[model samples]
Structures are given as C-alpha cells and as structure tokens.
Target: MSRKIREGLLMLISIVLLATGGTILYRQLLPSSAVKADGAKSGGQLSVRHAPEPKADVQGRFPAQSVERYAFSQEGKDLFSLLVARYQDSIGLPQSAVLFPKDAQEIASSPTGLRHDIWQSAADIIARKAPENALFLSWWDDGQRIHYLSGKEAWLRKPSDKTFVGPVWKALQDSLPVASDEERARLAQMARWLTMDSEKALSEIAAHFGASRPVYLLVNNDLLLHLAEFTAYGGTSLSLDSKNIPAGNDLHGDIALVKRWAFEAGDGNYLAQKEGNYYRVWSTPDAKAKNTLLVRLLPFIDSLKKLPKGVSLVYQSHWGGFLSVYKIDNQPIH
Candidate 1:
C-alpha cells in the first residue's frame, strides 16, 4: 500500500474502534428495559392491572360487632368492619382479617405507626363497597393506596398525570376560596357539577365517567382538615402556621387576631381551636377567605347527608372519618 493510503486506513480503523467501544459502554449503562423496543425504563414504570371481579362472599365476613368499638356510630362500625374484612380477604388470608386496635388509646398515642394499616383499611372499604370496575375520584395522594391495596381503579394515579390538567382538575383548583369573584363563581359552578344533589349535575358527572364504570367519590378526613394547605401549597410540604405564613400577609395577622378573639368570642364559624397547634379561620359563611378550601368543602360534605334520590352515602367511618364513599347510581354502559 502507498504510505499515504496506509496512514489513512490506520486513522479510519482507530475511529471505528473508539466508536464501537463507546456504543458498548452506553448500552451497558442503560437499564434493561430502556433498550427494549418500547423504551420503557426497568422497574421505573407502573404496570396497569385489570380490575378484580367483585366478590359477594367478602361481604359476609364483616360483622357490625367486630368493628363496633373502633367506630363512632353504627354506620361507621359496619363500614369499618367491611373494610377490615376486605383487607383480610385481599391478602389471601380469609381466616385472618385485620381488626382495629381494641384500645382507642393505642391509636391516639401512635397514629403514625398505624398509617399504612389505616391506608390498607381504607383500601379494603373501597374494594368492597365500590363495584368491580368502579373508578374512584379523589386527590392523587390516595390513588396508589386504593389501586395497589384495594385493586380498584382511580381517575388519576398521581397529580402530575396529564389527565389532571382538564376541567375536573381546574374545577378542583378553582374550588379553593383564594381567588377573584369570577374565579369563585367558577368554583361554585364546578362544585355543583360534582357534589350538587341535582339530577342534571349527577347525570353530567355520570356521563363524564361513561356508562361502563361506576364513579365513587372518596373523601379522606385528613385531606379535608388540611385542604387550605393543599389549595395554597399544592401539597403537605407547607402548613398554615405563623412560620409558614409570609410576613405582612393578612392571613398571619388574621389568624393571630382570630386566636385572640376565640378566647373571648367562644366557638363560631370564623375561628376555632383544634387539638394541637392547628387552628382554623374563615372570613364568614357569606364570604370565604383565600386558602380555605377545607372550610368551604365541609358544609358541602355535610350536605351529602340529604343527597338526591339516586345518590347515596354508601359508607363513612370514625377513624378521623378517614374514608367516605359516595355512589352515583347511574346505569353502566356495559
């Protein structure tokens, strides 16, 4: 070969060798699933599972006496029992259903210790009370527990899901009392769309969910208590406290003034003291202030007691009222 040609050939071979080594290294670093045809990440993506068929036998396991002491009311007891029974059956231990702690003090002392157990209990209730293919509507936080523990379907598994960007999510966001009059009006309209006892609104929601799957509204008590924080901060990372409230903001002064006034005024709508460092304040029944979605939703939730003819409060429990299930009796398409 000519000297120039030999040199050029050597250069080309070196470049080829370097490129081959780099490609091999890159593939080795990539996750197994990432190299798949679908380009999914290994163990990083959630797998969608088929909804389980409802079982009639599961209902028989829950007895009112079993959960009576754990619950506050007869309805609460029955619901609690049903959830416990459901959880027991779900884990393939039909004979060993989990029950609430016999001593209420134990729960009060260490609520955090029982958090997962509580979640599992709530999941059981959802699994048993809701239909086989029921689609639960609730905040994204509870979606995973309902899905993995209960084997039920949820509208959105996480807040960042694209499905959260539409009217329903917007309505929920607008439902917060922290906005303009026009915004509040929009919020009111949306609240009515979901929670109103009107046949038309109920029908619209049913249509939104479609005919094949029933829609169950799941309300977590903790979610209701901290709704203001959720609305303002979009998560539990922030709370309504003196430290969290920005300096010069009206809310800080308002809360302090409300706390002072509560000592004299006694319990009323505008201010009330909670068990711990928490306290609640609102502008008035006629005019709700910003960051008070929880306060606003409370009365609306109470109104569920007298639901329209077709709607029903299927379940409620005492453990912080941790779970409330509402069913809209719209016929399923399937």
Candidate 2:
C-alpha cells in the first residue's frame, strides 16, 4: 500500500476506536437521575416520580365496631348506631325506609338483634357497592382514623386534616351538619352541570369518569326508594315471615329485587349494578344514602375549584331517580 493510503486507513481506524470508547464511557458515567437532570436543564425532557407497587392487605379487615368506636364520641356512637339501623343496609331501600320513625329515641327502643343484623347487612351492602379500584369498607377505628391493609404504608388520615391524627382516633361525631359551604358551592356547580343537555352531560360524564366506573346522583327522597325497589335481593332471610326483619330488610330487599328484575326480567332499559358505567340515583326519606353520598362528594367536589370554566362534570345514576339532573349555576340549598 502507498504511504498516503496507509495514513488514510490509520486515521479511519483511530476515528472508529475513539467513537466506540466515547459511547461506552457515556453509558457507564451517566446515571438515570443525571440524564434526567441534564435533559430537564435543556428544557426538553421531563422527570416523573415512579410510585412503588402496592402491597396486599396492609391494614387488613377492620371490624365495623372498631371504626365506630374510634371515630365517634359516645353520643355520636349512639346516634350513628341508630342511624345505621334506621337505614338498614344503607343503600338498598326506598326513601320511605327513613320515615319508619324519626329521631334516635325511636332507634333505642328497637331490638339489639335487629340492630346487629342491620349493621351487618349495611356493611355487606357497602362492600358490594364499593368499586374494586376504590377504597371500600364501612368501619374504621373509633377515632375516625382510617387504616388500610394494602398498598404503601397502611394507615391513612384524611388529606384535609392537618394533625396527621391516627392510632385509636375517635369516631366522627354524629348529627354532623351535611354539606359545608365549599361542598354546597361544588354541588351547585355539579347540579348546574347536570342541567345541561343530555348529550352534553353524557359526553362530560364519559370523559371525566372514564368508560369504566359507574356514576351516581344520590339524593334523599322518593327517587332512591324507587331504585331500591330494584336492588333488594340475596340477603339472609330476616325471619320466617320476611316482613319482620327490620335489620336486613333494606339491603336484602334490593338484592332480592335485583335478582328478580335485573336478571330474571332481563330488562336492558332498567339499570342494574351488574353493568359498568351505570348510575346510582340514591334517595331515601331518612337520608342515610343521601348523607353517605354527600360525604363521598366532599373531597371529590373540592377538586372542582381547579376545573376550567364551562367544563361540566356529570355522573351517571345507577338507580334511575331524582338526582339525575345537574344543578347548573343555581342556588344551593343552604
């Protein structure tokens, strides 16, 4: 080979060797964080925190009484117990179930066995109603502290509470006024959003709730009663004469009806729990479902302050009833 040709070949080999060494050095020296930081510094890439996988059953199953005991004051406990019994299984009842009697005085006179059965039935109903992706369970520690057995560390306090309160917390007090001003504001917005055209509502709901989860417009009125007429089924028999079971009647009735109508009748038009993206139009004269609905709505509606103007949120009612419409830009019930 000529000297010039040999020199050219040597230069080419040197370039290749240099390129290979630089590539290997870059891979070895650059940590993931360093790369991410450098990319961010360039204003082109983003860094995200990767959450760890959740552990199973971390808090385990807490007893209903434990939650009641921890979350409530003595008076609250008494009132809550009565409230639970009055509504029976909570979700599976006509609005009229609340009117069987008024006030805690009436519940105190009721039988213990009846109350126990109602409490158990209500827990079962809640478990059934809770979504697989969402947090489910009725009871908490007596101090109103919530601990879960799965995913991350077990004990969780409500995000809004500043104290980081936990460990033998008191049960939430009873006769707690429903719907704070902030809640009312959001609900008013929600109501107005519902008042929009059905097509609008449907589209908004599909977008916000995703295609998977069911939506609900819960209320305390005849509407839920009608829906509950459809949910009652599969509860343990209350007594030899089914009418005597005040404890399990509310939920059982729903299980029974759902079994009969939702499946047996095979009515596609009638909404049932079996379907995804269904609506729950819960209403009850006693207002347990209504109260529960309000409680659930609190944190969710708080998030609405961040929503863009004219962007309405819509929920689908599982049980067809009064809460179906959105209350748009209207006065909230004080």
In candidate 2, position 272 carries an lDDT of 21
lDDT of 1 by residue, 1-334 (tens): 7867765563343222222211010011112221111122234321111122234323232322221111211111211111222233334532212223323324332233244455656677776666787887655445534655577765533332222233223222211213344533433333334333245555666676666767876664344333332343232221222211112234345345553543343332332212212233322333222123333322222232234544456665443233556676733223
Off-target runs (Cα >4 Å) in candidate 2 are 1-126, 129-131, 134-186, 193-202, 212-334
Instruction: List the RMSD of every prediction in angstroms.
Output: 26.3, 29.1
- lDDT tens string, model 2, 1-334? 7867765564343222222211010011112222121112322222211111222211222322111111111212221221211111123421101001122223332222232333333334333443444321111110011112111111111211211122111112231223345544433434333233334544564465554533333222221111211122111111100011112334445434433432332321122211111112111222222122222222111111232232232322221111221222221111
Error of 2 at 45 (Å): 64
For candidate 2, the lDDT comes to 0.24
Model 1 lDDT-worst window of ten = 21-30
Off by over 4 Å in 1: 1-110, 161-203, 225-284, 287-305, 308-310, 330-334
Q: Please, what is the whole-model Cα lDDT of each candidate in the order they appear?
A: 0.37, 0.24
